[model samples]
Target: MDDCIIIGAGPAGLTAAIYLTRFHLSIRLFDCGSSRAALIPCTHNHAGYPAGVAGTELLRLMLEQAEKYGATREQAEVTAIVPVAGGFDVQIGDRTAKARTVLLATGVVNNRPDMDPAEHDAALQRGLLRYCPICDGYEVTDKRVGVIGTGDHGMREAIFLRGFTPDITLIAPGAAHELDDACRAKLDEAGIVHVDGPCTPIRIAGDRIAVETPAGPLTFDSIYPALGSVIRSKLAVAAGANASQDGCLEVDEHQRTSIPGLFAAGDVVKGLDQISHAMGEAGVAATTIRNLLAEQRPIRR
Candidate 1:
């Protein structure tokens, strides 16, 4: 049986593999090869990369580093996991492997906005359109920005966007009643314009995003879709582990899930979805797993 199995190849999974391998434990990383981080053009907040680095480059370096330490990465979709005698059995296609410990770093998938001609336009992809305020909010400093969403999380994004740009508009596709009074007050205090109702349509022309609203066609330098992400924590949840309301796995500070021998880190756990945070959690989880395994050794009676 392998010492541990990491269920992703993102920043967290790769980092965990690096640490576990250093502890002289065998690790297998399974991933479907799609990473939300890879979709980002460039990330500025990752530590050590002062000038910033492309998401793809960071992932490549991480995987390469893990491989250097004898970590094995498999490109496969994990269908299910069943608890076994000493560990768990992971099913991939028609094959299965036993693992003494499991680290779920499956991460999350952000729901994309409805496809439109504006989104399909080539220029927007070049650099005009962006997401992840932590990644590109600085680029929109002092510029007109539009935020699309209406819940607490959406308001939080609006407040964050306000810090970067004075001209902030909150687009609520539903009735204004959906938002609480406290949230409304916060938006008012920030002097953010609120549009309560359906958005007509949006198109990207040159460097501007044109949106038709009840008032009229308004344009902004950028639009931030504050719609939250859908966490993929079913594998852990099905194993009798707890999760947050948003589906992020509930793990201890050591990144150990409710189920013993099962751990989680990165975006899969309830916390900031940042590369630095993921790496830190991975380190803790690797150490915890190593200690757990060491304790499991039979005593010399």
Candidate 2:
């Protein structure tokens, strides 16, 4: 059996693979090609990249680094992970790979707006549609921004973005706004415009994104969809691991999950959903895994 099997080849999984492989531990890295990080056009927040780095470029570099140290990678999705005798039986269709430990870096999927996929992609590439203001709020600084969401999640995102730009609009994804008294008070105090929605993306013109709202067609330099995400924790939860109500995996400081031989990192574990944070967690998890396995069996050159 391999020393470890890592699922999801994002920054977290790849980082772990690099560490474990450098420690001379055998590992198998699985990727389903749906890493949220891959969608990032360019991120300026990730340290050491002054001109900012494209997500794809970063992942490519990490994968290369991991491979340089003999980290085996498979471009296949792990459907199920069953805890077996000494480790886990990672299922990928008809084949199964066994390892002494399994690390999950399977990240979350963003819930996008109801726009046409082509249009959405175009707008996203053009920097007119965005998510995660924390990642790229600087790109939209002091520009008119529209936020398509409501309730606490919407309110919080709008308030956070307010620090970047003064012109902000919070529009409900449904027919009307769902703000309670406190939510309204907060928005009012923050000077955010609240509008009823069921909004649809009308068009994307030069440097502006247009959305059709009940109030009328609205245009903004950028639009942020505050809809939540679908956490990809089903594999771990199905394998009898404990998770929070929102489906985020519960991990201790060392990134150990409730299951002894199973571990997790990245967005699945819930914290700051940033690439740097995920990488840090992966580093800790990889070291812990090395120590734990050494306790069971000695490592030698």
Question: Which predicted model would earn the best TM-score?
Answer: 2
Clashes of each: 0, 0
Alpha-carbon deviation at 23 in model 2, angstroms: 0.7
Q: What's the TM for model 2?
A: 0.99
Q: Lowest-scoring 10 consecutive residues by lDDT in candidate 2?
A: 198-207
The lDDT for every candidate, in the order shown, is: 0.84, 0.94
Return the TM-score for each candidate structure: 0.92, 0.99
What does each candidate score in C-alpha RMSD? 2.7, 0.8
Q: For candidate 1, lDDT tens digit of each residue in 175-250?
A: 4525788889999999998887465466676678777767777788888777678898999898889998879999
Pairs that clash in candidate 1: none
Question: What value does the lDDT take at residue 198 in candidate 2?
Answer: 86
Report how far off residue 105 is in candidate 2 (Å).
0.3
